[model samples]
Target: MGWIEKALMRANRWHFVHSYRTIIAREKRKHPQDRERALMGAIGAASRADFAAQGDAQVAVLRHHGLSDGMAVYDLGCGIGRTAQALLRDGWRGRYTGADILPELVDHLRAQCPGFTAIVQRKLAIAAPDATLDMVFHWSVFTHLYPEECFLYLQDIHRALKPGGRLIFSFLEFEDPAHHTVFQTRTANFAVNGWSSVLDSFLHRDWITLWARQIGFAPPRFTSGSDTADHPAFWQSLAVLDKPAPA
Candidate 1:
């Protein structure tokens, strides 16, 4: 790209960040009395039913991808224990830890699902020891992060995972028609209004595969967002990257 194009991109990003912060501030003002509500809104879950439904769908996806008992698992960007609660209800007997950037979400997760380890994640790093986890997954987390941020998280996830461990996360892509709606809405908002409340990032399969390979993971597996036979409500495209076990 030319220098002028690069400069324009940076300016747009700065505007989006400013608008996002403004929207967040407005939300905070709207929910001064209820931190939990504000946090839930930020994550796009409006009510307990909505949250539980989404959690159930996430649990289904995890199970479909071979989530078995006794595996040490970490839920990155684990907002308010959505999947954790579902797992607990299903009598999941495994070592589970949940982490998120928001302390209120972590605290609420702890309160909602006692005995499950939930911590406030300040940086784009996992707290677990190296090679200790069986699986690390996040739903609707990477869809909002920049490409570089996603790459950084992948590097840390590789460090935290055991050999042959998996990183499963949901994302958005332009290849899927269902996802184009999200792209259209966000882009239209930005183009017409000059800013949008949320920043929606999209990734391509080729890019993700390249990143995974560069980070020493096996070729990543992708699931279409429209494939909802298993998890009806979870529509975001999913990717699974497994750390290669030693020969």
Candidate 2:
């Protein structure tokens, strides 16, 4: 990391520790997805509200290209299986596998969403056969990884996907110059000892375009963020990494 970036990160950490303690390393996960939905409803309490607002913005992207039953979907960072549940609830007749790095989370989804497979994926690896996943989603997952890790995982995600398969994800990208700036961008208290508490916390914008090309992801579409910020760069991208060449 360059000196300025390192210094900026250090400054952010100090600010959080000295001032933003309450929000830093928060006591509880603020966004609560209704766990009950994992059992009965398609969306859980944690992200239902936002997903509701975006209007399943990600799913709409896929449907535009044609999404239907008989397809298989893999939720890469399937936290609490909220998105997975939502997809199924929408009468998306297809196979669903929700994978996350958390085993407890996998158990929750497995018990709650019967017939839904919750695979424990600790690293970037997708625990599926090559070219198995027909439709995949990282959801808000990439918003958490380090840029380098994001690149690696993107490749991994590509490997697990079938050629011509679709991969859906969102980015904290600076696709437009209208927005995407950090002011008083001090460290979120999710930092420890001047380091990040969450993996995706320190992300900037450039990584999006770089990683997309590295993974061979094809042309992408951008959707504006539904927030007051109104910064065009706070946009979410729905990209389909082109199918990899056969091994």
Q: CA lDDT of 83 in candidate 1?
A: 91
lDDT assessment of candidate 1: 0.84
RMSD of each: 4.3, 7.8
Error (Å) of candidate 1 at residue 69 is 1.8
- What are the per-residue Cα lDDT tens digits for candidate 1 across 1-247? 9999999887755443344455556667879987767666767787768877888888888898889999999999887788999999878899999987666668888998988999977577899999999999998888878898889999999999999899999998888888888888988998999966677899999999999889999999888877777667567889989999999
Worst 10 residues of 2 by lDDT: 16-25
Model 2 misplaced regions, further than 4 Å: 1-58, 174-196, 201-210, 226-235, 244-247
lDDT of 2: 0.58
Model 1 residue runs over 4 Å out of place are: 1-38
Error of 1 at 74 (Å): 0.8
Q: How good is model 1 by TM-score?
A: 0.85
